[model samples]
Target: MPFISQIERQSDYSRFSSSTPIVIDNGGSYFRIGWAGEDDPRVVFRNIVQRPRHKTTGETVTVVGDHNPALLRYFDCTRSGPRSAFDGNVVYQFEIMEYILDFGFDRLGADQSQIDHPVLINECPCNPNQSRCRMAELLFESYGVSSIAYGVDAAFSYKYNQKKGICASNGLAICSGFMSSHAIPFVNGEPVFEACCRTNVGGYHVTDYLKQLLSLKYPHHSTKLTWEKVEDLKMENCYIAPDYASEVKIFQKGDKEAEEKTRCWQLPWTPAPVEEQPSEEEIARKAERKERQGQRLREMAEAKRTSRINELENEIRGLDFLVKQLEHVPENDVPAFLRDTGYASKQEIESNLAKATQSLRKAKGEQVENEEKGDTSNAEKYNLLHVPDEMLTSEQLRDKKRQLFLKSTAEARQRAKQRKLEQELEREKQMKLEEAKRLENPELYLDLLRAKYQELSEKVEQRKRQKTNGNNTNGKQNGSGGVGRGERLNAAQRERMRLLASAAFDRGKGEDTFGRDDEDWQLYKLMSRDNNDDEDDNEADLARVSARLREIDPTFVPKSETGSPAEPPGFRPLTKEDFQILMGVERFRCPEVLFHPNLIGIEQAGLGEMAGISLRRLPSNDEALEERITKSIFLTGGSCQYPGMIERLETEIRMLRPCGSAINIVRAYDPILDAWRGASQYASDMQLFQQQTFSRDDYFEKGEDWLRGYKFRYTLT
Candidate 1:
């Protein structure tokens, strides 16, 4: 399991005297605090703070370090996430630092008005003078401490390991922490800060890179790959490869060893419910319901027809009575009588009576014999037309001309009806011939029909592709960029563009004669955006072919009407494979960044390279000292706990040193806690604290120049 916060308050604070100094290993990743001379810190937690709102009380409260995520249900954490005080291993934000300090001291059982013990804390190597001054001011002014001492965490770890006989006095310490990695060469049991080198790539970069790559590869589970979770994953699975390229090849070929190394994290999922088929009785009940609804509709339609027939019969009787009454009235009184009945004249009344009689017969389900009546009335209807116009009066001549017009119109309509009947006969004959041919060879006929359908479909699709400029690779049309100024255009559009370009550039070359010829005016029509003749013709031809195939072939299924390729269904039942996160190459690829900082775009020397750089920067010119330093190289930090880290570092350092040089690498007893333990042991010496620490009065009296040049001695007895 990963490290959990030890925030249970210690109850023995009152037992210690006021002179006992407080040792704090203020690291970029964790904050450890304990009393001097102790074997372990009294309080340890992640160096982070969160200001979440209480769900019940609706007030913001500070939550420091990792808490029981289950208990967080009582708070609303949307506004503020966990925040750190360090910016790339430097404490620039003091406000957050203050919160972390408050939690650390409170957990250590400090109940006094202000912390009164002398404090010993660790800071990064070569820390800026401004940052150190601000830190001193905070401790002296806020905590009211009598004196404070600052030291490097890596130096403390090195001294602690040295006391344990892990390495000689002259050696190198490779400290790879959370935010950055450093290689500090120690001479005679003292850390040499002037010869140290740092690379801004460490455990934090590895975890972040893994999180990003996994989130992009499986975007649907991005929310599940939290920073804390990814950090845990990196610690559990990541390792330094002996040969990056060769090790990656094992995974690329999917070898058995790679499979054995792979880890799978299964997410939550549930199977979809199976659908049940309906019973025979249920299907019968639905059919009966539909039949009853149809019967009700038929009865209502019959009643409506009966009511309409009765109304029409009454209208016909009234019109016939008015026509009979028109014969008795004088011609002068007929106009007034017809006006009261809403008819213009006797002829109009007769026409209305005939139309009503025909409608009443049809509504009663009896066909009207209009064709027979027209055939019988033909002789009387054209009687005036056959009379000689010159031998009759002027009124007779006008009546004969009207009768001739009616006769010609009637004949033309009959001819049209006869032509329509002949065309229908021809279509029936053609269908019979095709049906006979199919009956003789059904297989051949179906093959021919399918081929015809496919050809027409392809032709139509090709036209659509040309119009769209064929950029629809994802099955979605190029809605915006297909026909823009610099994009591809169709044949007609290209020609039009060429014409416009010529017209524009031709004006400056010579005298313009744009509209001198009649044909030149036609250029505007060609450039019109409404030109769609080819599209319309293609659509009509496709429709005709599709209809013909559907009539001839029983197994024909036309493609979708939208012309675009059919898209897959949006929803699918998820399976175990969908939820499983596999770790193949990712296991070692993330940690590989430490040995090759350039892999993650960082241009600094890696941890291994930094060791060689540190050795070269030593002020000593003796080759014997360099050889001795390489013999006692020590790896001590939180990141040094990886499985193959020692081996990988030894190999890398050997490559950088001279041939046949002796190389040695050892790990600290407890990489994560040794820094705090070492500081606790060192701070136990009261006389050493007086020698290395500075009082607040000295800080002001000695001036800023004195503080800038201040150095701590780590070899104190």
Candidate 2:
């Protein structure tokens, strides 16, 4: 069953007699307090305290234990986390502890000038005397309690259970509490403190260990692994495996039974909506719209061209009329006629007619056929190209030179076309041969393809290395030595370092002849940035292989742009699985420390050893006493609730006992609340009034030393 706090403030505090003592089980995990002789605690809460400044008021408020997380938004809690009074299961910080006690007592209906009733508080075993003294002083000075009694919570629990008839008067009490676990022998209904053992491990360590392992395994989900949530998970799913090695083997081999044992948590995820393909009718409409747009553009261009051609033709006719008029009026009148027609002379008018004719031809979309014309008019345009220079005029000589230039350009174009055609045929033949080989044995062909891809990939990788190496060298050549201070390079970058060092040292040695020749300049060019393309061919080959593999293997994926093989560093997204913290070994591992205190880095005897230690501490070493103690080994405390805890303790204690000694280990009826209940019942006794010694004089005479050594007789009340 999951444990929960009972925090409703008691209303009948004033009704209880003034002599009735208040009992508190102040543990590291929880704080429980109630009137003596009650069957249950009146108030219980987490032992933690928080001090947060109110968001609106900016005043620090003491919040004792866990509350609604949403309400915490009104306070700034980033500077400080929730604090506890305990330091390794012992109360070392009195300030925080005082605040908690104040809250506990206040909620218990303490409205008087001071707490006038007697108080009973639980403390850890072997608590430092300084801490105990401070606690006593605080109660005396501030709260003004009439009297105080200090007792161990585990021992109280053990005694409470013994009275309940759960165990004999003499037995072993293995109490695994919040921050620590202990085993004490109850000899004749009294605890043997000197022989008691403690192990500094409990539920806290178990929860922490599970949280760490889960967070490390699923970094993405770490945010959800809150301490509180992990605690819940630890209590819910965690259990002890009798044998860790054998249990792990079940999971390691992935047995069917292991699958049944394994649990999974599905995180909230919604797949992204996929895009739907456009409808046929929609696609047709789009195509039609595009075609209509193209038609309109074409029509607009044609109209513009027609208008230009008409303007050119009109200008040509006007120019022709002016030329005709000039021919009739003679050469002297030609300039006047040309000027009226926007032409300088007859030659100008002729040039205008020729330009208009060319415009008209282009507007009609007819090829100007300059290259074809050059071929057809070869003899007429460049007649002197075949003739000797001695028989030609200077004008003819220039024409022959122009023809020679045209002929060479046409020859170059023809050669390029032929080469391209031949290369295309060669590629087609190679592709057909590869296809035939694939048809022969598809599986083998795929294997070969994969092998080829791997080879090509390696080559490309090597080439990349070479390029990077070359860059490093060039950087060094530019006098930028050894990369950056903290920069690391792949294998190629390191090789470049070696090359650069060799090149640098090789210079100026037996060679004052460094730049004596032009070849030395070429050496610099070889080492230049542009010369880093040593693996271009290898890259091209890889590209081809990758393309071929993609064609054959449906599963083959080419990683180039976004799928580069580089892992990102740092936290990823958390899943529900991360929120699911499982504890298999942790359940026993935590409580196991009760039998082996060394597990939690604590060098102390465990619970089993503590029983023996307590017996050894006894003033009496009688065999009958030992047997009586072994007969009533009572288990108590919150931690004793584990399934096989009682049996394990019995087995361990029996081992330490004599060959035929009788041993019994029993669990308390209500280990968590029995101590407070028992104390409450004791306080209700009218005789308790006689034990109450109040006033400042009694405390003053008692002194701090006497308060430090104060012990309670639970059975007396």
Candidate 3:
């Protein structure tokens, strides 16, 4: 079950007597506080602290435990993550721990300046003297507690189950807490700390392992696998395997039982809307509208052409009349007649008449191939008679130079056209040869062309991928492009980043003198993310092969835009199964870390090995004592609640013990809360409480040396 906090304030704080002791289960995962002799704690919360800045005040405020997320939006908590008071199961940071206690006591309706009653808090087994002294100092000075008593939570759980007659007085307690696991042997109903075996694998490690595994498998959905969500998944599905190797073989072979055991957690997803094709009536109406628009454009073009033909005819008539009038005048009067017009001489008028005649013919939809076809036809077209400049006037020399430049330009255009026609002839000749070979052996021709087309297509595809991202050379590419860029970068991309950094820092030269040089602009082109200078020469060759294959092989399909194979249209609607995270072998594989700590890279005893290690470390090797301890193996704490934990622990312990050793493994009724209940029950007796507990003056008088040897008596509880 998921853990829920109870931080509501209680109303009856003054109802208890001054001598009444308070119990607090200072667990690594949570903090449970209440008055002694009660069945359950009055207030419980996550033992976490957050110091966030207020949005309006810009001052930091201490927030303990979980609060409404909407209310937290008013604070800027990005500067730090949630801080824990405990490192492993031992409290080291008392400054943060004081805030936790303040919240716990405040929530329990403590409005007074000081707590008049004594307090009982649980700590880790064999906790360091420095940590113990710090806890005592914090309680005595900060909270003003009358007295304090320390105990191990696992020991409390063991004695609580012992009081219920669930196990014998002589036994072993395997308590798996949040950050660590311990196997403590109980002799005469009291825990032997010297024989305890502790491993740094617990519920926290199992949940963390599961989170990492899921994140790596479905990396795109890693953001959804929050610690809280994965913890819930672990509680619901994780379990201990009877034999990890044998259980894994079932899943590896994909047996029917494995499929039955698998569970799935579906995530939230919404299907996108599908587009519908146009109806036949709509298509017909669109085509009709397009035809009417085309008709109007055709009428407008005809009217423009007719108007241009009329203007050209009128201009030609006017020029003809000028020529006739000039012919009637004398040669000397020609200069006088031409002065009225814009022409400099009679040859200039003839030049204008010839150009008008050519333009008029061209407007009548006639070709001008003969006009620009041959260079021999226009040898004298720029006729300055190849004259020397000394024999001509200054104006004549300028005209001759202009004519030479025009002649050269026109010849160059003619040469380019001739070359293009020659290439076209060569291509037609190749096509005829190919047709002959296809007719001779159609099947062979089809096979040869198909092979060539496939090879060229692969080459073109490879070149395209390399140009887009050189890192995609390996097989990390999915349809979603390639591997993400954060973890990796191609050589070109790295260079670009280096250039950008260099430009920003000015190479440590100081002063803002960028963009002064012309070459500096070229640096931006190299640094640009979209700039790809690589050429694709194979694309043209692939197009040629694809076109040839299409001519001979009717079944041939191309991947180009115009010849692409059609896929059935429309998207498949998303289903619940598409978003589900499947738990097959992972359901047991992750929890198997409890029995094999090496799975998570920790070289230590696992949960099952801890029991064997604890038994071996006993001072005496008495068979009867070992048998009694094995007979009443009590399993407690949150991690011990997995489904097959009892059976698996019994099997692992049996292998270490002699033949037919009595191994009774039983779980606590409520592993999480039983320790608190046990502490409360123990603190009820005033006589025993007064003997073990110490006041603030006693703590200061007797320092760390005395606190090191102080131990709680669990047998009396």
Candidate 4:
């Protein structure tokens, strides 16, 4: 069963007499306090505190114990996390411990200037003298207590169990607390401190381990794995696998059992709203708007074109009139007539007229028909080509050479057009052949298409790799790009880097003969950055293949858009099972560590081994005493609540004892609170008022060390 804290303030503090002793069970995980003789503690709370700043007021406020989380909405707790007083079962930080003590006493209704009653507080086994003294001093000075008694919490539990006739007077008390585990053997109703064993592993370590593993497994939901929530998860679901490796193997194989074992906790999630497709009216509205915008743009463009055409037409008319006016003049007077205009000569005026007509046709969106125009003026364009060398002067020969160059250029343009027409015919023929093959067998056609696609993709990929390497080399040699210090470069890049470095330092060693030969100029070409742009067509081919595959194969997945080697992992929707941290392996694993500390990270011996160690420490190894202790093996502490704890301990202890030796173990009725109940009952006995319980004078004169040797007589009480 999951443990719940009871920390309600008690109103009957005045009902108890001033001489009544107060019982306090100061455990690492919890604190319980009550008036002497009470069956249960009047006040109990988690042994933790938080100092949070109020959000609205901006003032730091001290909040002790667990409070309503809703009330904490007004506070900003980011700066300070909930802190515990105990460190590995030892109260080290007195400042935090003081706050806890104050909260405990205040809730117990300590209204007087000081507490008038004596106090009985629980402590750990082999309680350090330094820690003991601090506790005594705090109670005496702060609470004004008459006297203080310190006893191991486990021993009190064992004694309480013994009173209920659960076990013999002599037995082992395996007490597992929050941060540590301990095993104490009770001999003749008294605990033997020398025989006690301690292991630095308990409920806290198990919860922390579960928390870390889960956070690593589901990094996206790490914030959900709070310490308190993980603690609850550990208690509710975690369990110890009898055989760890085999149990994990079951999960690894993903059997039905493993499927059943997996639990999920659903986090809050909301479905995204669905987008509705546009209605017919909406589509029509958008189309109308687009058409209107296009009409406006078209009109503006037409106005611009008309303005340009008009300007060109006016300029052509003026040129035509000037040429006509020049034609009216006599041939001998034409040069003088052209001089009146801007023209240098008759030929210059005719050339200006031709240029204006060509520009006007172009502005009007009419094809210039260059080939037709060229053919019509061929005789004039190459007039000197037909003239023989003997029929022309040296100046005429120069003009013939210019005509030959123009004729060759026109032939080259004609040849290029013929090649383009032939390519179009070849593509059409190939399409007909493919259609005939597809008609024979559709499956075979698809297979052939896929094969061709694969071949093209591989060719494109290889070309891309080669181009990338080439670009890296060019970049390295040009000193424009370098790999980061921690990054790795391609092989070509590394080689180019080496060559450039060697060339830089090779300068002063010999005479300058770098570009003496044609081969030497090739080095400049290799190092040039212009070579990197050559792969653009190859990348386009790869994109074509990828698009084709996507159209054909519905299941085909392209490489990641991130360009990384692998895709970044994303979080799947959390189910109820994901949030649940199953305790199958952890249940017994945590409690078992109390028996065998090596299971956890601790190197100390377990409870059973420690019992043997404790027995060996005794001055006299008496068989009867060992037998007595084995008969009354009382289990205690908050952590002794696992289902199979009694059976597991009994079996382990039996293995340690001699073959025929008797062994017995029993659990307390209420391991968590029985210590406080036992203390309260003991303090309430009237005969407990001995002279040793003492006057105030005895405490002052004897000093603190005198209080260290103080022992309680439980049998008398």
Candidate 5:
């Protein structure tokens, strides 16, 4: 398992004396703080901080190190994720560093206004003078430390292991830490910074590469690949391969061994509930209920029709009685009688009676036969149409024009009816022909029909794609050509635009004769918004083809228009494969970067090459010194905990050394905590601190230049 925080406030902080130094292993990935001479750090946590706004209070609060993720529910963490103080293994942001230090010291049970103990902290190899000075100032001014000592983390691990008899006085320490890797050569029980080589590739690069590859491979699950989760996965599964290329080949071939090596992380998923199919009885019940509702509506409509028919019949009787009374009365009295009946004349009364009779028949569900009677009177209806207008009076001439218009309208109606009949007959004949062809060779006929349908569908779809500038398969349109300055136009639209442009610019040019030609005037009509005949024709053709395809092909499914509703989620049952995150080649591929920095686009030499480069940079050209360095090669740091690291590094270093050179690879007792353990052990010695550390007053007098040259000797007695 990856390291967890040991942040329980120590209750016995007052028990330790003031002279005792507090040792802190301020590594890139984690922070470890404890009293000197302790086996393990009393307080350890991730070196990160987050300032999230409280959800309920709307106040931004500082949260240092890793906390229970459940408690973060009260804060809106979107504004700031977990931020580290280091940038490429160097502390550049002091504000974040101060927060980390405060948390570390608080967890170590510091209750006073300021810490009163001497502090010993770790720094990177060949750290910048500015960084070193700023750190010293922070400790001396902010924390009120009396004195401080800075030492390399790898050198501490090397010294700690040397005291434990893990390596000799002259050896190589290959410490692969969080952000970078280092190969430090130790001489006479002290680290030689001149001979050390640093490669900017380490655990951080490995985890980042793994996270990126997994995210790219499974974009849907990219949100699930959190940094902490990926770190845990790396520690659990990733191992340095004995032979990267060969091991990759084994997975590439997909053998049983590869299957055994592959790990799977199943995400949270629940199966979708299945819908139960209704039984015959349930379907029948629903149909019966619908039938009862329809029957009740029909009865209501029948009752309404009967009532309307009776009322119409009564109106017709009253109108007929009024017309009969008008005929019985004298011509002078008939006018007064018709006025009481709301009619102008006897003919008007008759017309009212006929309309009421026809309405009554219609209400009773009987046809009136009005169209047949009207057709029979066609000769009499157009009698005035045959008469010449010159022979008629003014009123007669108006009647004659009306009769002529009625005759022409009747003729057009008859022609339209005849054309509709002919079309129906033609369609029936064509369907019969298709049916006969299908009967003769059903398979071939189906194939031909399918091919025709596909062709027409593609043609229509291609036109749509061209008009909308959309993808045919995905149906996504490009927004670039949408109505603006550089917008695309169709052929006719382009021509109209060209005409408009010409008309606007032609006046200033030597072409003032725009309206002189008839064609120039026609340009105005083409540029008008009414020019849409081609678009209408294309739409008609597309609709006709689509209808024909739908009628002939039983399996044809039309494409949905854009912005339609997508399929509902849980449409398909959840499967195991959907949740399973497989680790096949990624298991070893991530860690392989240690031996090949170029894999992650880093130009620097890898861990293996750094060893040889470090030996080359040594001052002595003696082969015996080089042999001793190789013989006691030490692997120390968090990254050295990978399963096959020792074997891989041994094989890698052997290739770079001379033939038959005795090489011994040793691992630190606890690669991760040994650095802090070594620092704690070294700080416990009171004489060593007095010899190596500088007081706060001494820091002001010595100046930054002097501080830059200061080095802590690890071989002090």
Candidate 6:
């Protein structure tokens, strides 16, 4: 593994001459910079930029690379994350690229107004001219570099390995980097771009697949699986499976080998909030506090009652005094005397006194009359009802009519009360009978009750589904489907539709007597959306059955509006194991995406398949040339370092080739830094390096057409 550490600024920048070429591998994942032909890059950081606000200053500052854990406390980076300047290894956003370059150059200890040295950067294969032009413009205008050169990272790694005798001049380079993977066929030491194929599946996709799996398996621990942590896990544990199905079967069968291979990352687990028993003192104090609150509430209620009783007594006394005073006054002077008490006459004063006396009795906790003593009061209350209209005066006749109305209203109310009391008695009798049956045979009664509940619930659910056009609990259509133009409707809605159809079909066919008949006016009510009048009856029956079942059976749970159990159907108690996430199949399963990209929903060719595709695309139909490419197959890039990668690729390519074909899959000396090392070796020769690069004057004079046609010759290196 490459040594990953925080990049420190170099102090020996001035030791290198101005003519020294700076090597930069502007990869999608990381950035590296140093003098050309060096043993290693002097500075390295994640190739990402961030503009986060300082928490104390509230100023947005440009920060490059991964956020340091120590520095995160000083910045509000919630709204921003490490952002890449490349779009799949090709520079697209110049502003972000500028930030990355600034950080890379600063870390390399560039302390000049202009870099002065030539820059050699790596880009993806078949990069567009727009990307090159933008990069060239930025380097020339922003950094003021002496010259700029571009090379593919894969090509550099391939050439570097080829010179080391790891691969032949005519071979294939299978580089699985961060954002994407590539298989480039080489002919006479030059990478064959026409025969190369790229799969948009690499380390990033593998890490993402693993992250998704972890999220699904342990949703509560999402924040624990950061990208960097998952990347580390991938590096530490993930490996390509020799055969996906057979490998998966090992885990599926729960073999000991699978358990041995499974990796466990024990996250920081905190104990759950267990219910602990309280000490005697704690319990006693709690009970005392509760009792004090209850006593205070009771005292408050008692005080309020006493205050009300006193007020009622005072009102009664005042009314009694008014009544006594009115009794002494003359009849003509009675109205004037009562006027001061807001009463018009002696009868009004007596009515007020009677109300106050009744209230005072009630507030004093005395039994008050029910006021519904119709059997006793009816005779005196409607005395005038017995008198004939002609025998009585006009005022008496009016009173008789009012008394008659009141008598009928009172009788109706009494009948309703009697019916309600009889219904209650009947319900009580039925409940007692049901209770006796339950006691006689509890299981049988419960089964019968559950059956009834189930039947009613289904009936109610069907009716509800029809009314809602098959919408589920979420108000969205369920698997059965939604309410389209031909949606099934309830009986009332169907009838309304039938009536509407008839009305529409009758247009110009007969006389329009729609509103002539009184029955025709009822059409609009039936056409209304709320036409299901008997739905409530079915729901009420279902509710009754559900309630009965709940009363008898502890396991019975009521269905919700959508007919699903309000709570989980079976009360399967969750254990700590449910919270734990065990990774068995995922170790090899995630890395298998490089061989089967379809697992991640990407329809691109896999890494091994890309090799086959690249070989088939070669113009040379000679079997010897193809054999040479297969025999010296070289694997480069960070993702190619997986434990079983070479074995898997060998197995995959062996199946595609003819029997006994020479298939040697070799890993790069350093899959990651070899690209930079290759570029360094290529840039060591000043004459050859200068030939491959373009100065600022050359760029403006030749125009973009020349830049589009640019390709560095690795053979010269």
Each candidate structure's TM-score, on Cα atoms with residue i matched to residue i, is: 0.72, 0.68, 0.75, 0.68, 0.75, 0.71
**lDDT for position 568 in model 1:** 78
lDDT of 1 by residue, 548-660 (tens): 77887666777864555778789988887999888878988888888898988998898889999999999987899999999999888777877888888888999999899
Model 3: how far residue 544 lies from native, Å: 6.1
Model 3 per-residue lDDT tens digits across residues 1-717? 111234567989989988999899999998999988889999888889888887998977777887667777888989957999888888888888888888888888885369888999998888988998888888887778899999999888888888888877898999998999999999988889999999988898999999999988888789899999999999999888998889989998897888899998989987666679989999999999999999999999989988988988888888888888888999888887889887777666766676677788888988666556245335446667477889999888888988888988877897989989998999899989988998999889888888887887886677566556644656466566655653255566667777776784593377556677777777787678354432234566677888777776787778775566677788877776778898887788888888889999999988778999999888899988988998889999999989899999899989888888888888887899999999999999888888888787787787656787787886663
Residue 290 CA displacement from its true place in model 5, Å: 4.6
Give per-residue lDDT, candidate 3, residue 666: 88
Clash count per candidate? 0, 14, 0, 23, 0, 0
lDDT of 2 by residue, 525-577 (tens): 55554333545656776888888887788898775634686678888564445
What local distance difference test score does each model get?
0.83, 0.71, 0.83, 0.72, 0.84, 0.83
Candidate 6 Cα misplacement greater than 4 A, ranges: 1-7, 52-60, 68-83, 125-151, 159-170, 186-195, 208-230, 248-269, 290-327, 344-413, 423-566, 569-590, 598-604, 616-625, 682-717
Error of 2 at 543 (Å): 6.8
Q: Write the per-residue lDDT of candidate 4 for residues 1-717, one digit (tens) a residue.
A: 111124566687888887888889998888888888779988888888888888887887777777767877888989988898787888888888888877787788886348878787888887777887777777777678887777778877777777888866777778877888887777678777777778787778777777777777778788888888888777766654544467678877878988787665566665546689999999999999999999999999999999988888888888888877876888888777766776766665666677778888888878896676675367656767877899998987987988899899988898989989997898689867866887788678768767766666665656554445544323353355543531334455556667765664465355655566777667766875434343554466557556756765687665534355766779765455555444344444444566656665778876667667766666578988887777767777666666666676666677788888877777789878888888777777745643326334565777678766776555552
lDDT over C-alpha atoms for residue 557 of model 4:
65
User: Candidate 3: TM-score?
Assistant: 0.75
Worst 10 residues of 4 by lDDT: 1-10
lDDT score for residue 294 of model 3: 97
Clashes of 6: 0
lDDT of 6 by residue, 1-717 (tens): 111126677899889998899999988898999999898998888888777787987988777775567866788989987788877767788888887787788878895458989999998888888998888888887888999999999899988888888888988999998989889999999989998998888889889999999998888889888899999988988888888899988888887998898887776556567789999999999999999999999999999999998887888788888878877988787666767678855655666666777787887788988476544446555767777777899888888888888888978998999999998999899989999999999989888888888888787867667555655445566455655433445556667777776874375367565566667656676577456556776777787777887676787756674555467677665555555656778888998989989988899888778999999999879899999889889989999998998998899998899999999989999999999999999999999889999887887788667898887888893
| Candidate 5, run of 10 with poorest lDDT | 481-490
Better of 3 and 5 by lDDT: 5
lDDT of 2 at 438: 93
